[model samples]
Every structure is written in C-alpha cells, then in structure tokens.
Target: MKPAAFDYHRPDSVEEAVSLLAELGEDAKILAGGQSLVPMLSLRLAFFDHLIDISRLDELKGIERRGDALWIGAGTTDATVGADRQVSAAVPLLTRVTPFVGHFQIRNRGTFGGSIAHADPAAEYPTVALTLDAVMEAVSPRGRREIAAADFFTGLWETALEPDEVLTGVRFPLSNSRSGFGVHEFARRHGDFAIAGSVVAVRLEEDRVSHCAIGLMGLGSTPRRAAAAEAAVLGMPLGELDPKQIGELAMSGLDDVPADLQGSASYRARVGAVMTARAWTDAVAEAGGEATHA
Candidate 1:
C-alpha cells in the first residue's frame, strides 16, 4: 500500500521545523531518519497531511559530552551512535544494545531520537534510555523543556511530547567506574524483535550489591523497570546473589504483559525472567562481583 498523498516541507533549521509544526498542528509530522515512519506510512498504518523534513538539520546532528551526561542529537542516526567512541565508553549499554536495533542498513538511517520518540516497547533504544534514566530534551514555541525518561513514555506508540514540540536530543548519564552494564534479549532469530529482553546496570560496594537497575522489554505496554526485582537484590552479598532468583522476581510483579501471536503471557514471562537472569549475571560479574546460588 502506498502512503496517502501529503505535503512535504523541508525546513532550514530546528526553529523553522518547530514553527512549521506549531503552524500545521495536527496535520504535520516531523520526518527525521524515516526508518520507522516511512514503513508505517507505506503500509497506510498512519496518516499525516504534512511531513516536515528535518533530516538534514545541522542543529539536530551531533554527539557531545554535556557535564555528567552525554548529549545525543535527535537527528543522529543509529549507525553514528553505534560507532561513536564516546558513546561506547561513556554508555556501554547503549553501544552493546545497538546491534539489536535492526540490520546495519536500517541502523544506518534509523535516528536515535526517532526510535525513542516512536516509543516501541520492544526496541533496544527505549529500554536503554529508560534503564539509564536518560532525559529527553524538547523544544517548542513555548521554549525548551526536559522530560525524565520515567515520565517520557506514556503508552504504546505514545509519549508526553505535545503536538508542537520537537525532540531535540537525549541526555544519558555517564557510567561510574564501579558500575557495569549488560543487555540480553530472547528473540527467535538474530536481529528479530525480542519476545523478551532485559538491560541491566549494576554497581558493587565491596562484597555487596550496592545498586541495580533492570529494564525489561517486550513484556509490557512500555519498556519497564524491574523496580521490585532490583529492590530484592539490593545489599545482597556476592555469594548470595542468584541470577535465577533475580529473574523470577523480575517477572513476579509484571501484571500487564501482553499475549499475542509471538507467545502467551506465561511464555513471555518465562523468557523475560531468563533474559533478566542472564543479564544480571553479566552485570554482576562486570561489577567485580560473582553471582551464584551458593
């Protein structure tokens, strides 16, 4: 199916794009990498009368260190992000998870902000952002505002972004020396959308687990944090930190898991638990602690 006819506008700058969006209101949509949007449009799954092309806007295309966080421009492509040395060093989880975003061709054109704004629960970027508590920065005629990752995603393909607002960049906090990150997802095949997945960051304090963050994907309406599971493992001694039990606790409190053609709710929960456990083990080991049932 072909996308319905629409007006295309190429704006010179982000301010111009924002102005176009504000002026066009509900009729317009921002066109960044077009990896996701183009597919939806081609399938006739979504319709917008006007597409404001901001793909070449220089203002929205850079990666830089901003204080304690790394700032990634909204228009920056996944390929660029995956290849960046600073991103790999400062935010290892993001780099490690990038290979799962899609094929290299797709990653070549899929924008970092586009994936986040698309708000796909199963996508690697959203889970990473949520796991790191990355802050989303947006602009509008009103001015610039920052939204915490927790508050950014509202529901399936939905976000807190207003109609006239444009996502400018995302700020991910830098990892500490004591922290280690890992990601695991259970996809049926390589590069496929995961049925269940987990991204974890763990910080160790001597012989105990000092802090842990767990983000589960493809198991809820939105990428979710395993807060209860994280809390269960906190202060656990290295010898007592069992990844399998951590996995179970991660699945225990999930009430809104989806059941569909991919798998039943119970099946997905099991996968989620396994993924979480594997990721936990990786994270714990990297954090200089060994996880074992003993």
Candidate 2:
C-alpha cells in the first residue's frame, strides 16, 4: 500500500515549521528522519494532510555536553549517537543499547527525537531515557519548556507533547565515576524487538548500593521503572543482596504486561526477571560492587 496524498512543506527554520503546524492544526505532521513515520504512512496506518519537513533544520542537529547533562539534538541519528565519544562517556547505557534498535540501516536514518516522540514501550531509547532521567525540550507558539523523562511519556506511542510542539533536543544527565549502567534484552533474532528486557544503573560507595535505577521493556504499556526493586536495594550492603531476588522484585510490581504471540504475560514476566538479574549483576560489577550470589 502507498501513503495517502499529502502536501509537503520543507521549512527553512523551526520557527517556520511551528508556524505551519499552528496553521495546519490536526492536519499537519513533523517529518524528521521519517524512519518511523514513513513506514506507517506507507502501510496506511496513519494519515496526515500536511508534512512539515524539518530534516534540514540546522538548529536541531548536534551533540555536546552542557553544564552537566549531554545535550543531543532531536535530529541526531542513532549511528552518530552510538559513535560519539562524549555520549559514550556521559551515558554509556545509551551507547550500549543503540545497536539493538533495529539493523544498522534503520539507525542510519532514525532520529533520536523521532524515537522518543514515537515512544514505543519496548524501544531501547525510551527505556534508557527513562532510566537515566533524561530531559526533553520542545518549542511551540507558547514558548519553550522542559519535560522530565518521567512525565514525558504518557501512554502507548503517546507523549505529553502538544500537537503544535516540536521536540528540539534531549539531555541525558552525566554519570559519576562510581556509577555503572547495563541494558539486556531477549529478542528472537539479532535485530528483532525484545521479548523482554531490563536496563539497570547502579552507584556504589563502601560496598553498599548508594543509587540505583531499573527500567523494564517489552513488559508493560509504557517504559517502566522497577520502582519496588530499586527501593529494595537502596543503602543495602552488597553481601546481603541477591541479584535474582532483585529481578523477581522487578517483576512483582508489573500489572499491565502485554500478552501476545511472542509469549504469555507469565512467560514475559519470567524473561523479564532473568534479564533484570543479568543486568543487575553486570551493573553492580561495573560499579565496583560485588553481586555475591552471581
């Protein structure tokens, strides 16, 4: 199937792009890398009368370290982000997860902002953004504002972004020396979506857990943090902690996990538990803490 007919407007600037969006209302859509949108259009799954092309907007492309967080422009490609030394140093979780975001061909054309805006619950970028507490920046006629990753994603493929707002960039907070991050997913094939996955970040001091974050993918309606599991380990000595237990706790909090052809909800919970355990062991090791039972 081919996409429905639509008017294409290539905006010279973000200002012009937003202005067009304001005028076109519900009939308009922003076309960044078009990695996700183009396919949906081709399949006739979505319809938009106007496409505001902002792929060439220089204002939306770059990678740099801000005061503390690493700022990634909305238009930055997955390949560029994966290869950037600064991103690797500041947010290793992102670098580690990039390769799993489909094949290299898709990454070459997929934009960071587009993925976040798409907000697939099982996607690596959204899960990492949630785990690392990244901040999203957007622009619209009402002016610019920052949205915390926690409040950014609202539901299935939906976000807090207003129709007229264009995501400008995202900022991932820099990790400290004591911090370590790990992401693990179980896909059937090399580049397929995960059946279940977990992302873990840890900070250690004096053989005790000081800070921790655990994110779950392919197991819920939205990218979710293992809040109960994180709470269980805070300030707990490494000797008394079991990575397996942590993984179990991660699954204990889930309620709306999806059940489909890939697996039943119970099956997904088990996979999620194992993935969480694996990620926990790696994260603890990297943070200089020992997972004694591992």
Candidate 3:
C-alpha cells in the first residue's frame, strides 16, 4: 500500500512551519524523522492532505542545557541522543534506554520528538520522559506553550498537541549526583516493540530513598507512572527493599493491560511485575545504594 496523494512543504524555519500548519489545519501533518509516521502512512493507517517537513528546521536541531534542564531539539535523532556526552551526564536514563528503542538503522532515523509525538505505549522515550517529568514545548500560529509529560499523552498514538501545533523540543530535568536510573523490558527480539517494560529513577538521601519514580510501558493505553510502586519505596533503606514486592505493587493498579498476539493481559501484567522489580533494584544500585537482591 502507498500513502494517498499529498502536498509536501519543507519549511526552513519554525515560523514558516507553524504558518503552514496553521493554514493547512487538520489536513497537515508535521514530518520529522518519519520513522513512525511514514510506516503508518504507507500502510494506510493514516493519511494527510499535506506534509509539512520540519526535519531540517534549524530551530529543532541541537542538544543543549538551559538552567536546570537539558533541552533536546525535536529533530535530534535517537542515535545522536544516545551518543551525546551531555545527555549521558545530565539524563543518564535516556542514554540507558535509547539502545533498546529499535535497531541501529531505526535509531539513526528516529527523532526524539517524533517518538514522543507518535506516543507509542511501549516506546522507550515516552517512558523515560514520563519518569523524569519532561516538559514538551509546542508552537502554533496562535502562540507557544509547554505541556507537562504527565499530561501530554492522552492515549495510544494520541497526545495533547493541537492539529496546528508543532512540537519544538523537550526539556528533561537534570538528575542530581545522588540520582540513579534503570530500565528493563521484555521483547521477543531486539528492535521489536517491548511486550512490557519498566523505567526507574531513584534519588538517595543519607542512604534512604528520598525520591522514586517508576514508569510502566506496554501494559496500558499509554505509558503509566507506577504510582503505587513509587510510593512503596519512599523513605525505605535501599538494602531492605524487596524487588518482588515492589514489582507487585507496580502492577497493582494496572487494570487495563493490553492483550494481543504478543501476550494475554494477565501475562503482560505478570511480566510487568518482574520488569518493575528488576528496574527498581538496578536503579537503587546505580544510585550508589546497596541492593541485597540480584
């Protein structure tokens, strides 16, 4: 199958892109890396009357730090993000999770903002963004605004972005010296979408867990914060934490786990528990806290 006929507009600047989007309205789709959008178009899963190519817009093409957060351009590729020294230092969880995104070729073409905009429930970037409370910046002819990661994702492949808005970039809060991160997922093969996954960020204060954030993927309509699990480990001594118990708590509130050929809802819930536990345990260790369980 091939995508329906469409007009192509490549804008050199974000202002031009926003103007095009505003003019084209619902008929326009912003083309970034094309990693996910192209496939959907080719399969007839999606169609647009116009494609506004912002892939080369200079405004969306760098990795930089501003104040307390690291800002990543919407056009930055996954491979570039994974290899960036600044990202490795400021948001290590992104570095740790990027390798699991897709194959090398996919990573080379997949853009950070594209994945987030696509909003796949099992995508690595969204899970990381949610766990870190990343903020998404979007622009339209009307104006510009920021959307919190927690409120950005509305459902599978759906986001808070208005039809005329183009995501410009995302900002991730820098992790402190006492922070550690870990991510774990179950996929039948490398490069495949995860069947279930977990991302954990732990902040230690005086050998006690001060802050914990757990994000669960591939188990619901959108990547979900494991609130129950995060609350469970608060103020607990690192060594005394039980991975099994933490894992159970993570899945306790997952009532809408998806079921497909990959697995049943019950199966995914079970795998989710295991992944959550492993992620939590490894995150604690990475944060310089001792973990008794392997």
Candidate 4:
C-alpha cells in the first residue's frame, strides 16, 4: 500500500524547517534519511499530510565537541557517525552498535536524529542513548529545549517532541574513567530488527567497577534502562557478579515490559537478562584484571 497523499516541503535551513513544521502542525512529518519513515509510509502504517524535508539544512549537519561532550547533528547519517574516529573515541557506544542498525545502504541514509525522534522500541540508537544518558536538542516556534534520552521516549513509536518541534542534534557526554562499552543483539537475519539487544557501558576507577549503565531494547514498550541491574554491578568485581544474581536484577526492572507476537513478556524478559549479563561479562573482561568478583 502506498502512503496517503501528502505535501513535500524541503527546507534549506533549520529555521525554515521549523517554520514549515509549525505551519503544517499535525499534518506534517519530518523527513530525514527516510529509512524508517518511508517504509512506514509505504505500508500505510503512518499518515502525514505534509513532509518537511530537512536534508538540506546545513546547520543540522555536523558533528563537533564542546568540553567533554560530543554534539552530533540530527541530520547526520548513521554511516557518517559510525565512521568518525572522534565519535568512536568519545562515545564508543555509537560506534559499536551503528553497524547493526541496518544494511550498509540503509545506514548511508539513516539519520541519527531521525531514529531518536521516531522512537522505535527495537532501534539500537535509542538504547545507546539511554545507556549513555544523552540529551536531545530540539527547536520549534516556541523555543529551543533539551530532553533527556531517558525521558524522551514515552512509548513505542512516540516521543516527547511536540508537533512543531524539530530535533536538531544529540549530545553525548565523555566518560571520565577507563570506560568500556559493548552492544549485543540477536536477529534472525543480518539486517533485521533485533529480537533482543543490550548496550552496556562500564566505567572503572582504579581497577574497580565505579559506574555501570545498561540499556535494553526489544524487551519493553520503550528502550529501557536497567536501573536495578546497573546498581547490582556497580562496585562489584566483574567475576563476582554471578549470572543468576545479574539475571535477577536485570529481570527485576522489566516488570512492565509488553508482550507481542514476536515474543512473550516472559521470553523477552529472559532475553533481556541474558543479553545484559553477557554485556556485563564482556565489559568486565575489557577492563583487564581490574574487574573483581566476590
């Protein structure tokens, strides 16, 4: 099925894009790489009367750093972000999981900001953002505002973005310790959406697990942060975290996950726990002998 009829407006600048969105209101949708939206439109799963194309907005098209944080433009493609050494060094999470987003052709057109705004529960970037505690920068006729990654996704295919607001970029903070990151996902095919996935980030302070962040996708209504699980591994030696203990903590926070045809609540919860446990083990190994088990 083809998408319903819609008007397409490609703006050359950010201000113009925001203006178009404000003018179109409920009928408009922002078009970035068109990787996700186009497929939705073709399947008739999404309906928008207007398409505000921001591909030409040069202002929203770069990656740079300020202090310890890296700011990636919303319009920047995933391929670009994945290939940049700066991003890989600053936020290894972005580099580690970007290759799994889709095929190479899709990655060439998939935009970073677009994925976050789309808020697909199975998307890797949202899980990464949640794990990193990134911030999304958006602009609208009302004003500019920043939304925390954790607070951005209200539900599956829903976000905190107002109708007139356009996401401009995402800001990721650099770790202050010898941090190691890992992203893992299980899929039937190479480019298919994940059945279950996890992104783990561990920060070490003098050979001890100082801070840990774990985020899970394809197991909940939204990309979820395993807060209880994070707390479980903090200050514990990597070898000390028994699989059963970590699994219990990880599953503890998935009480509200939704069930679907692809997986039951129980199955997804189990996958979430398993993936997170593996990620924690991998991250701990990367920390060398500093990882402790008790």
Candidate 5:
C-alpha cells in the first residue's frame, strides 16, 4: 500500500516549518528523518494533506553542550548520536541504548527528535529521555516552550506537541562521576522492538544509593518512570539490595501493562521485572561496586 496523495513542502528553516503547520493546521505533518512516518505512510496507517519537510532546516541541526546539559538537535541522526564522543561521555545510557533502536540502515536515517515526537512506547530514546529527565524544546507561531520528559509523553503515539509546533531539540543532563547507567531489553532479533525493556541511572554516595531513576518501556501506553522501584533502592547500601525484590517493586504499581500477540500482560510484567533487575544490577556495578545479587 502507498500513502494517500499529499502536497509536500520543504522548509529551509524552522520558522518556515512552523508557519506552514500553522497555516495548514491539522492537515500538516512535520517530516524529520521519516523513519517511522514513511513506513506508516506506506501502510496507509496515517494520512496527511501536506508534509512539511524540515530535514534541511539548519536551525535544527547540531550537537552542543550548554552549562550542564547536552543539547541534541531534533534533526540529528541516531547513528551520529550513538557514535558521538560527547554523548558517550555525558549520557552513557543513551550510548548504550541507541544501538538497540534498529539496524544500521534505520539508525542512519532516524532522527532523535523524530523518535521522541512519535512517542512510540517501545522506542529506546523515549525510555532514555524519561530516565534522564531530558527536556524537549518546541517552537510555534505563538511562542516557544520547554516540556519536561515526564510531561511530554501523553500516550501511545501522542505527545504534548501542538499541531502548529515543531520540536526544536532535546536537552539531556550530563551524568556526574558518581553516576552510572545501564539499559537492557528483550527482543526477538537484534534490531527488533523490545518486548520489554528497562533503563537505570544510579548515583552513589559512599557505597549508598543517593539518587536513582528507572524507566520501563513496552509495558504501558507510554514509557514510564519506575518511581516505586527507585524509591525502594534510594539510600540503601548497594550490598544490601536484592535485585529480585527491587525488580518486583519497580513494576508492582503498574496496572496498565499492554498485552498483545507478542506476549500477555502477565508475561510482559514478568519479563519487565527481570529486565529491571538486570539493569539495576548493571548500573550498580557501573557506579563502582560489585552487585552482590543476581
């Protein structure tokens, strides 16, 4: 199947893109990398009257560090991000997860901002954003605003972005020396969407957990922070932590786990727990201590 016939507009600047969206209203769709949108269009799962291509917008293309955060342009490709030295040094969780997004070909054309805007529940970027408290910046005809990662994702394929807004970029906080990150997921193949996944970032203060953030994907309508699990490990001695108990607590509060042909809700929940445990354990080791539990 092919997409419905639609008008295509290539905008050289973000302002131009926003203007097009404002004028076209709900009929306009922004095209970044088109990794996700192109497939959807090919299947006729989505249709738009016009496609506002912003792939060439110079305003949305760069990677820089500001203060304590790394600002990644919305137009930056996943392949570039995964291989960037700055990304690896600043936010290792992103570095660890990006390779799992898709095969090399897909990553070459997939935009970082595009993934966040699409808000696929199983996408690695969204889960990383949620775990690291990344901030998304958007511009519109009205004005510009920053949306916290926690508040950006509303549901499956839904986000806080308005119809007339363009996502400019995202800002991820740099991890300090005391922090360690880990990401783990289960997929049918190397590049397949995760059936269940977990990302953990831990900051240790003298062998005790000082701060922790856990994000779970493929188990809910949107990638969600595992607040319950984070709270369970905070301030606890790393050696005293039980991976099994922590994993269970991490997902215990989730009641909306999605079920599908890939697996049942209960099965996802179980796998999610195991992944959370592995992620937490790996994170703890990376933070400087050997994990005592399996």
Candidate 6:
C-alpha cells in the first residue's frame, strides 16, 4: 500500500524545523530516519498532510559529552552510536543493545530520537532510557523543555511531547567501573520485537549493591521500573543471593500486565521473571560482584 500524497519540507536547522512544525501543527509529521514512521505511512496506519523532514538538519546529528552524561543528538544513527568510542566508554548499554535493534541497514538510518518518539514498549531505547534515568530534551516554537525519561512515555505510542514539539536529544549518564549494566530480551528471531525483556543497572560499592534499577518491557502497557525488585536487591550482596526471593520480588513488582495475542498475562509474567533473573546474573557478573547462589 502507498501513502497518501503529502507536502514535504526539508529543514536545514532545528529552528527552521520547529517553525515548520509550528506552522503545520498536527498535520505535519517530522521525519527522522523513517525506520519506524515510513512503514506506518506505507501501510496507511499514519496519515499526514505534510512531512517536515528534519533528517537533513545538521544541528540534530552526532554525539557530545557534557560533564557526567553523554548527549546523543536526536538524529544520531543507532549504528554510529553503537560503534562510537564515547558512547562505548560512557554508556556500553547502548552499544550492547544496538545490534539487537532491527538490522544493520535499519540501524544505519534509524535515529535514536525516532525510537524514543515512537514510544514502542517493545523497543530498546525506551527501556534503556527508563533504566538509566535519562533525560529527554524537546524544543518547540514556544521554548525548550527537558523531561525525565520516566515521564516521557505516557502510554502506547503516546508521549508527553506536544504535537509541535520535537525531541532534540537524549542525555544518559555515563557508566563507571562500579556500575553494571545488562540487557536481555527473548524474541523468536534476531532483530524481531522482544516477547519479554529486562534491563538492569546496578551500582556496587565494595561488593555491596548501592543502587539498582530494573526496567521491564514487552509485557506491560508501558515500560515500567521494577521498584519492588530494586528494593529487594538494594544493599544486598550479590554473593548471598536467593534466586527464588529475587524472582518473587520481581514478579510482585508487576502488579498489572497487559494481555496480548502473543501471550497471556501469566505467560508474560513468567517470561519477565526469568528474564529479570538472568539480567541480574549478567549484571552481577559484569560488576565483578561475588556470586552467592552458585
């Protein structure tokens, strides 16, 4: 199927792009790498009267570092960041999960901002952002605003971003030697959307857990932090771990999960618990934290 005819405008700068979006309002869809939007357009799932192409806006491309966090431009390709020295050293989780996203060709064109804006619960960035407590910067004709990743995604394919607002970039804090990050997901095939997944970020000090974040995807209406699991693991030494207790805490954290054609709520909950446990194991291994249950 072909998309309906639309007017296209290529903006050279972020200001110009914001102006176009403001003028066109809801009728305009900002084109990033088109990895996600193009398909929707082709299937007529998304209809727009105008396309404000920011793909060429040079201001929105590339990576930068500010203090403790790495600022990734909205237009940066997933493939590029996956191989970047700054990104690899600063936040290896992005590099670790980039290969799991779509394919090489799609990653070459897929923009980080596009993934965040799409707000697909099954996608990697949203989970990563939430797990890392990243910040999203959005610019509009009115002004610029920064939103926490937790507050960015409101629901399925929905976000706190206004129609006229475009995400400029995302800022994720750097991982240090004391930090451990792990991403795990199960899919029928490589690059396919995850059936269930978990991302874990932990800060360990002298073999004791200081801080922990557990983000789950593909089993709920939206990405959510596993607060109960985090609380259970916090201050606990990884060496004296109880897998059953950990699994129960993780399961208890997910009070409400959505049922889908892929699986029932029970099935998803089971997968989620397994993934969460595996993620914890991997994260502890990476952190050099002692293994207790072996």
User: Lowest summed lDDT over 10 consecutive residues: which window, candidate 1?
Assistant: 285-294
lDDT of 5 by residue, 81-132 (tens): 9999999999899899998999999999999999999999988999999889
Query: Residue-wise lDDT of candidate 4 within 229-273, one digit each (tens)?
Result: 888667866556664567558778466777767777888777877
- lDDT by residue for model 2 over 149-204, one digit each (tens)? 99999999999999999999999989998887888999899888889999999999
TM-score of 6: 0.96
Clashing residue pairs for model 4: 237-292, 238-292, 239-293, 240-293, 240-294
Superposed Cα deviation of residue 241, candidate 6 (Å)? 2.2
lDDT of each model, Cα atoms only?
0.92, 0.93, 0.92, 0.83, 0.92, 0.86
Using lDDT, give the best candidate's number. 2
Lowest lDDT sum, 10 consecutive residues, model 5, at 54-63
lDDT string for model 6 (1-294, tens) is: 999999999987888888998899889999999999999999999999999888877778889899889999999888888899999899888888898899999999999999989999889888899889999999998899999998999999899999889999999998977887778888878999888888888789888899899888886777878888898778987767765456557778565677777787888888888888877777877888854553
Cα lDDT of model 1 by residue, 1-294, tens digit: 899999999999999999999999999999989999999999999999999999999889989999999999999999999999999999999999999988999999989999999999999999999999999999999999999999999999899999999999999999987788889998888888899999999999887888889999999999999998989878978787678888999998788999999999999999999999999888887888766752
Candidate 3 lDDT over 190-256, as tens digits, reads 9899999999999999999999999998999999999988887899887788888899889997789
